[model samples]
Structure formats: C-alpha cells, structure tokens
Target: MTDVSKIFAPGGVLSQTIDGFQPRPAQQQMASAIAAMNDDAGVLVVEAETGTGKTFAYLAPALLAKTDDGERKKVIVSTGTKNLQEQLFHRDLPRIRDALAPDAIVALLKGRSNYLCIQRMDQFISQPIKHDPAVALQLQQQSRVVKYWANQTRSGDLGELTELAEDAIILPQITSTADNCLGRDCPAYADCYLVKARQEALEADVVVVNHHLFFADAVLKDTGFGELIPHADLVIFDEAHQVPDIASQYFSESISTRQLQDLAQDMRLLYGTELKDLRQLSTVADQLDKCGRDLRLQFARDPERGNWREQMRRAQVIEDSERLADTLDRAQAIAKAALGRNKVLDQCYERLVLLKARWQQLTNTQRSGYSFWYETTPRQLSVHQTPLSVAEKFTSYMLAQQMQWVFTSATLAVNGSFKHFTDRLGLGSAQTLVLPSPFDFAKQAMLFLPRYLPAASDPTMAASFAAIAKQLIAHNHGGTFLLFTSYRMLNQVAAILQEQESSDRLILVQGRTSKRELLDQFVDAGDAILLGTSSFWEGVDVRGDALRLVMIDKLPFAAPDDPLLQARIEDCRLRGQNPFQDVQIPQAVISLKQGAGRLIRDALDTGVLVVCDNRLVQKEYGQTFLASLPAMSRTRDIAQVTEFLSKD
Candidate 1:
C-alpha cells in the first residue's frame, strides 16, 4: 500500500483492468508523491514530461483519498483545454474509477455557455430576425438539432452536438451567458441544463473543468457568488502552464464592439415587442452602433492590433467611448421610465448596465499595475486593461480557498528551473518536483540542427525551411509536423512545400480544415506532413509512428510589437529587470519545449526534432532551450538525421 505498485503492478488492478497497460516508473513516483500530499502542502508544481501518465498520477490519489465517513473526498480537476477536459471526464476517469474508486462520483462542468438555455432558445425561436437569410436558415436548422439533443442529452452540453461547428452562429442564440441568465426567475429554471450540471458537479466526488472556468469561478467566489470551490478539498490543474495567461485574461477588464452591438440588438428586439415611442432610446442605440464603427475605422488605420493606452487618452478615442457609454446610460434611463415592468425589457436593461460598467472599467485606467490595449478586426473593436501582475491576486485567491493545489504540466520548468513559473504565479516557496518522461529520448530520438539553413530572420528563410521540411518528409515518408510561430510564415512555407513536393504525399495545413479534422486526416493518411501554427504546438498527441518529425520554424517567441508582450517587457524594464532574459527567453524556452514534445509521445515512439532557427544553436541563450528539452541524440549532419529516420 505504501508504493504505487500495489495498484500499478503487473497483476495490479490497473494492469488487470486496462488493456496493454505497462506501468512506468514516472507514473508511480508521481502517484506516490500526490498520495502523500495533504491540505498543509500549500501547492505542488510537478513537471511530468510526455508519456508520464500524469492524469492517472493525480486522479488515482484523488480517488483513493477518503473522508472519515468513508465517502471519497471531493477533487476538482481543471485542464487547460476542453479537449483534455472531455478526455478526462469521458475517457480516463471511467477507467480509473472502475479500477480503484468505483464508488467515486464524477461530473463534467463547463461554463454556462456550453449548456443550452431552453428559455433563450425559445426566445430566439419566437423572435423575428429580419437580417441575414443565411443566418436565419442556419438558426432554423441548428435549433432542430439543439431540440433533439435537448430531449436526449442528460448533460445538455453543446459539445454533445458533434454535427455543429464549434463557432456555429446558432450557439449564442441557444446558450446563456452570465450577463443574460434569468436565474431563478426563468420559466425553464426547473429543468435548466446549466444549473443542473452545476448541481451534479456540486454533488459529485470529482469534477472536471477547464482553466477558464476554474478562474472564472474563482473570481466569482472572490465576489461571494461562486458555487463549486467551497465543496472541493483538492484541486488539480492539468496543462498548468496556461494558468498564468488564462488567469490574467479573466482578471482583466474588456469591452468589445460585439458586446455593444449585441446589447443594442437585444434592446431593439425588446423595444419592438415591449415598449413604443421610445424613439430617444432607439436613437441612442443607433449612436452606440455608429460609435463602435467610428472607433474601428479610427484604429484600423494602423496595424490590425495595438496598445491604445496613449491613444485612449487622446481626444477622439476618449470622446467616442464616452459618447458610447453615455448613450447606454440614456438607454438605461429610458428603459426604466417606459418599459420598467417588462421582463424582456428588464433583461435588455441588465445587459445595458453590464455594457456600461464594462465601458467604464475599460476607459478608467488610473490604477497601477495595469496595461491598456485595443485590438481592431474588420468587424469588431475591443479595449482591454490587464494587470501587470496576476501573481499576487492568484496566490491570494488560492490561499484563501485553502485547498491542496496541484499544478502539473510537461512544460512548466525551463533549464531545470521552476523559478519562471513560480515567480509568475507568486508560488515562490511552494513545493516543486520534476519527473522526466520515462521514454529513453537519447536512444529513441534525434535532435537535427541543419547547419546550412539561412538565419530565422533572413528573407530566404521560408524557402530554406520548406526545403528542409521536404527532405525530412522524404526521409521519414510522412508523420511530420512543420510548426510555425505565425500564420503568415505557416502559409508561406506551406505554399512553397506544396509546389515542390510530390502530389502523392498528403499535406494538411491548419486554417484550411478544423483541428480535429486535420488530426484525423493526418492519422489516417499516416504519411502526411501537417503545417500548422501555435495550436498544433501543444496538446496534440499522435502516438506511434503517425507523428515522428517535428520542425519548428523558430523559437516560439511572442511578437515584440504584440500589445501584451510589449506591456510585459515595459513592466520588466520598469522593475530594472532584463526583459529579454527575465521575460522573453524563459517564455520561449517553455514554448520551444512544448513544440519539441510533439515528436516523442511514448516510450516506443521515436522521431527527430528539427529547429529551423539557427538562433537555437548560434545564440548565447540557445543553451537554455537545449538544456530544457529531453536529452536526445544531437546532430548537425543531414546524413545522421536521414539514417536515424531510416531506422525505427
């Protein structure tokens, strides 16, 4: 019972229960550590590399832990992505439960938006949308699908509707957001799917969620309204490297053109049905729409995105935003006077209130440790203010909750140091552990650095990169992932390769198809080269020879001109810290590690990692990136790389 082998041994429950389950030393080590942890262990950061069976490492201990009453202790498992969350909830948890904790109850809790709101769907069905015929048609078709799922689905999660695209236009119409939910006042409150799901999560011994939902709930709890945090004694964060970024996003204030337009459109619907002669409100709503357009036109002149803090203080931007806020305030006054008692009108007014509040928060930037920025798309404009440091806030929030925290990821540490991750989360004194993947990288993998390729910043780099990719694909006969840092470079290199490569070899590029679809195609084709950007860098697992070669265009460094990156650099500079070393370098190292990890996923899996960036070998900081990766066989000779690929 003291060792994990009692459960993971050859004749143990796990081996007996799961098919082809060969236990690894890393998994046993991690499980032992987690089982030994108690509430007094402030937080634990574990860097379990690929193939470490990290999910079971945490889940096994969580399921095995019990209360005095013999009931399993509640554990909340939060992942960085919905895919991982679904896998944990639908696939992995069942196996673990059947083997160790059959009595353990499990529930999957997504955000409110993931559940269909019967009330909202009904309202949308009843409303006359005179705008786009295509949209109306899509809504009509998707509504029937939603209705069918509504009848059959116990969870009522939108994820169950696999036929619909993730970004389907009908989703928002049938789904409820925090701002739009009628709560207990809704007619369908009794059978509300979102509420029912939350109740299930509350009752379950284990709950699976994503980082966004976890932080949203944490923020809500800070405001005294969150429901799930109080019930769980242990919280496990998978893919925990994404926490700092996701936390910063949720903690910030943001107002977008779409929010304004949605509020206006909702007001129009309510005005037409519930109130009349509110011409002033209609005019103000029209003004709000115009203001949004004006702001986009004004900002879109420069780059598609930028930090508008200085420009936000300028006369034009400030005046326009104030005018938009004022219009909403006037609409609120008008709604109260005319459509005071109407429920639909009340909901519209509530949305307006939130819109106004968000606008105020975005414009008012007198507080310290906050950076303001704006992004402009062809159809939308947004203003955001994020804190320079979410570490203090995150640490306080976790400490106040008093739960045993576990943060595990394959990419948390850089150069064998957890300081970058810990400092970012203000968990400086927390316990940290690194469990390297049991896979023998040196024996199974090769790190190929081409000596003849152009520098990363050179104009001919794309052509050189494509040539290298073609050679690798030719040698390996597919199972290659050509990952780029940007879409522009991805498209450029992809086009170059497409023109030069044989027509028989399947080439799948991102953005041309859905990620799931692309992965399926890649696996089915077996000999296909996938050219993708940031999304394919991590959380993409293709065990066996289906994915063997991973080529990164350059170190995954954020664009210097990026608003958030720029702000972080400035923040570091202000603190008298070297931004390149303290911020950019560490971040890139983590990202590079994630990209490289895409190659060797399992013990038997073997591949070559080719970083096209000469800087990875030539720069002074290159050693840091090299040290951060698994100790694979390094080579500069093309002959060695081709020979290694020729083998298993």
Candidate 2:
C-alpha cells in the first residue's frame, strides 16, 4: 500500500499535482490515523480544526484503502449538507482521485426527492391543476420548462436545473416521496434517475451523500434501491457535529399535514384516472384534504415550533386533531375497499395505515424518553415524536454495521475534550483526536469582546449591537459578516445599519435570497456587509479580502424553550446531571466555535472577530468557551479591533 504520509508530504503527489497545495503536519497526521483505522473496524471521532485540509486528508486514505484480497475498499462519505456533498463529489474528490488514483470510480447520490420522478411528472402533465387560474398558469409554465429539461438531463437531478427556483411550486408535484413512490412497479422504473444513481453508487468504490440521506437510509433502509451502507467497508461523516441532531431527527417519527394533503391529492388523481369507478374515493379524499387544512388553521399563522403536549391541551386543537383522525379512517376505509383494483391505491392504503399509526403515536404524550413537538408553516403542520437521546440507537446501528467509522468536524470537541460530542452519540469507546488549525491564529486574528455591551437578553441589545457593527463596518469599509443567533436581532441590526451606512456600501441580509446567491454577491462586491443568522454560522468559506470582519451578536445557544432542549433538560435532571454544564454550555461552545471559525479561513487571511455579547467576560462559565477557541489574541477594546482591521 502507498504510504499516507508520502501522499501529503511537501514533495508528494498532492503537492505536485494540485495547485497551491501546502504541506501541513496536522493534515498528514489525520490521513495516517485514518489509514491505520482502515485496517480495523471501530469508531474514530476526530476534530480537525478549520484549515486542517481535512477533506483531502480523509479522501486520500479512503481512495487508497484496500481489502484483504487487494481489492479497492468500498467507502461511503457523508457530508452535513447537499452543497458540501456536491463540492466533495464534483470538486474535491476529482482532485484527490486524479492525484492518487485516476481510475478510481466514485458516485454522488442524494435523497430520492432531489431526483425528478418521471412517473410523477407524467401523471402531473396528464392532469390539469385545480389551483387559482393565475397560479395554475404559472405552474403550467414551470412544468413545461421541467419537461424540456427532463428530456435532456441524464442524471435527472433537479440541482442541475440551476435556473429553477428552489421553492418552485411544481417541485412537490414532480418529486417522489417514500410514501408516494411506486418503486419497481412504476412505468418509468427502467429510466428512474434515483435508481440509476443508486446503481452507480452500488458499483463505485466511493459513494458521496449528505447526512440527511445517510440517516434516512439508516432509519428507513428504503432510500436506496438496494441498501447502500451495508455493502461499504468504511463510512465517514464530515461535519459530524451535526450528526447527533440529524440522527435524532431521522430516528423520530413524524406526520405532517402536507403528507396527508399529498395522499389526498394522489387519491384524487387516481380517482380521476385509474379507479374512476370508485366514486366514493373523491369524497373521502376531499374530506381528508379539508381536515388536514382545518387542523393547520387551528395553530398560529406565524411559523413556529412548539411542544405538542401543550398544544393538545387546547380544546380546539384536540377537536381538530380528532376530526383529522376520523377523516383518515374514512380515507383508509375507501382505500381498503378498492385495494385489489389498483396497485397505486393499495400503496395509498398502506401509507394511510402507517400515517394513522404515526398519528396515534405522536398524540400519545404518555410515552417516556421522547419529546413530542409540532412545527407549523403557513400552510401545514408536522408533529414529531423525537427520542430524547439517539445515543443507544445510533451506537447499536453502528455496531450492527461493523464497518470502520469516522466522525470528523471542525467543531466537535468542547474545551479540548470530545466527551460532549462522544457522549451524545454513545461513542464513548471511540478513539479521538483534536488537530489545531494549521493557520497561525495569534498573528492572523484578534478576538474582540466589545466592552459595555448590553446583556444578550436586554431589549436594547440590538441597538448596542448595531452601534458596534457600525463602528466595525466603518473601520473595515464593508467585507463583514454580522452573524446573529436570532432572526429578531438580525432584522433589528439590519434595520439600524441600513439607516446609517453610506449608499456605496452594499448591505445584504439573509432570507432576501438563497444562501448561495447571497454569498456569491458578497464575494463579487468584495466589500459588502452581509447579515445572516444560524445558517451562515458555518459551512461558509470566503477566504481573502472578501471577508475580513465577523461580528457575532451573541453566543449561539439553543433556545431554552425549544422542545428538544426542554426534554433533554428534564431528562438530565432526572439523571442527576448538571444540564447547564453538561448539555447547554458544551452545545453553545461548539456553536460559538463554528461562528468564530468563519473569520480566519486561511493562513494568509487576517481578520477581527467582534463578539458583541459581554457574557464572555462577565459569566463564570465563560472560561470554558474561551478554552475551546483558537489561540488568538483577545481584547475588550474597540480601538484594537479597528487597528487590526486597518492593517488589512
């Protein structure tokens, strides 16, 4: 086998083939550790700090891994987001592959919904939409565009249609869900894009996917045509800090009004085409649809997530939910009556049974060790029964697979310890490593804890944050990221800055456009103040002069009232653990690390991180948060921050 160290050394294949490749001891160490683990089958949790070149470190070892018989080892690399998944598959993987093994086969597979279902699209085109005339016309035009693209697309991945809006109305109509997909029974089975992708993944030595799809497969084992992970010799999770929450989400059971609505719409479609003789199908389907919408109306119009146990205490909520259950029973009865008449209707019946069971489970607040919560959008409501901790479940699943597992992220350990992350996922026995970032942080960056800022909870906090931001933006002349823990604070500061900043300075806020577009605009403008919330905290990279200042509004703590957090707190209390120290502080520390990591992306990058919250200095637990961050020069003076920016 090729030496992993040689591949990452100064005079290595990577240095010779890849542009601007610099040798880093930490990167080589990480690659060597992973290569060593490839010979064994157990869990390894690594915290490869930002600028550690972790992607290449992990990729090199995986690309060269071999089985006992000298065959290439099968590996699955899962990322935290689709954007990173694409970046790895299309950009990073190819570079590593070319440098190490050009003949290696790799495949990128996303969730089933990302691929266009030809059967669903054909069904949609055959039927006329019953929406408002203007809306219907718009959807018709979008569908026409999709049809044209479908004819030309080989992958049928909707991401390839960059021209289409992410939230296009026609998307749900054309995509397939586990509940709606007919699988091998469909007319378009031979030309299915999802199946083709899975086939390629099955044959490839490396398969790249996102965390959501990975967990979906772990839970459902239905996302892939054949199970994808079980066949792999190794599995790696990047951005592994996100794994616990995402794994918990997949392990939970959820029932949504949109799902119920979709089932109704599908039944209605079947009634018009396949099972026209069943006149009662349309009535029950419409009733189910109305009940789902009526249940949604019982909740607040504003989008929010709340404890479902509390929600069910309301008489209107109970009454509406019971009505929904009754409607489901009627729909299931109708579906059962026409079971043998059509395969699609039979599938609908099976889906109805599962939905009914899930509804019952979600409504049962008596269940221990689970958090019952409901989230609402403008048009739908989804109730979930999430396990308080996925530690046992995840560990058992990992053990069952018996594959070499690696969990890595820039922000996994808290205060130089991996206990917080490892305990959450029950990887207590896993090997651990923490590699400091390759960048010289003390010289390249300054941590600014602005003095005399209002408390994070103060009503006037936004005003103080705006003042500090104004000062920093004036010093930096744009190229700033004012990251916030809450949208409320973000909007308030954005409003204040808009009124104060000069016309030539571009100010871009989140939610006005897609994250990708916002980032692209920020990079192109070279000097723009971008205000964003949680989404911009991490997985964002803007090296060089485009981003020289990052001001965090507050510590990125999970909201106290959040259902999952509340449940976890209660459970911790029962176990006689300090939820504040063990749970809240550690989670916040990791989050703060992620937010701070956005500043110094490269060794050549110099920046000032202005944390507007004074808690870092005033609170007793502040030292824990401080110890976890990079070794940067710290100050409480605004002048020092300005001076640092002036150097740029």
User: Which candidate tops lDDT?
Assistant: 2
Residues 1-648, model 2: lDDT tens digits: 799999899989888999999999999999999998844567889999999999999999999999889999999999999999998999999989988999899999999889999988988888875899989988988988898899899999999998789889999989998888888788899999988888898889999999999999889856225563436899999999999889988999998999888888888888898888888988988988898888888888999998998888899989888888888788888888777888789889989998888888888788789889999999989999988888899988877877999999999988889988888889999999999898889999999888777788999998888888887778884499999999898899899989988758889999998999999999999889999999999999999989999989888889998877876777678779999988899989999999999999988999988877777888988999899889999998888888888874
What local distance difference test score does each model get?
Answer: 0.83, 0.88
RMSD of 1: 2.2
1-648 in candidate 1: lDDT tens per residue? Answer: 235557866687888888888887788888888877755545889999988899888888888876556667788999999898998888999988888878788889988888888988888878856858887787788878877878898778888899888989888788876766777778998988877888888889999999999888777532112454335778899999999888888887788887777767776766577566666666777777888888777775554767666777778888887888788788878777765577766777777777788788877777667888888776888888888878889888877877788999999998999988888788998888999888889999999888977877888999998888887777895588999998889989988988889758788999998999999999999878899999999999898889889998988898887766776787788789999999999989999999998898877898999998888788889999999999999999988998888785
RMSD list, candidates in order: 2.2, 1.5
Candidate 2 TM-score, C-alpha based = 0.97
Identify the candidate with maximal TM-score: 2
TM-score of each: 0.95, 0.97
Model 1 stretches astray by more than 4 angstroms: 1-5, 68-70, 221-230, 277-279, 301-303, 338-340
lDDT score at residue 143, model 2, on the 0-100 scale = 84
Model 1 reaches what TM-score against the true structure? 0.95
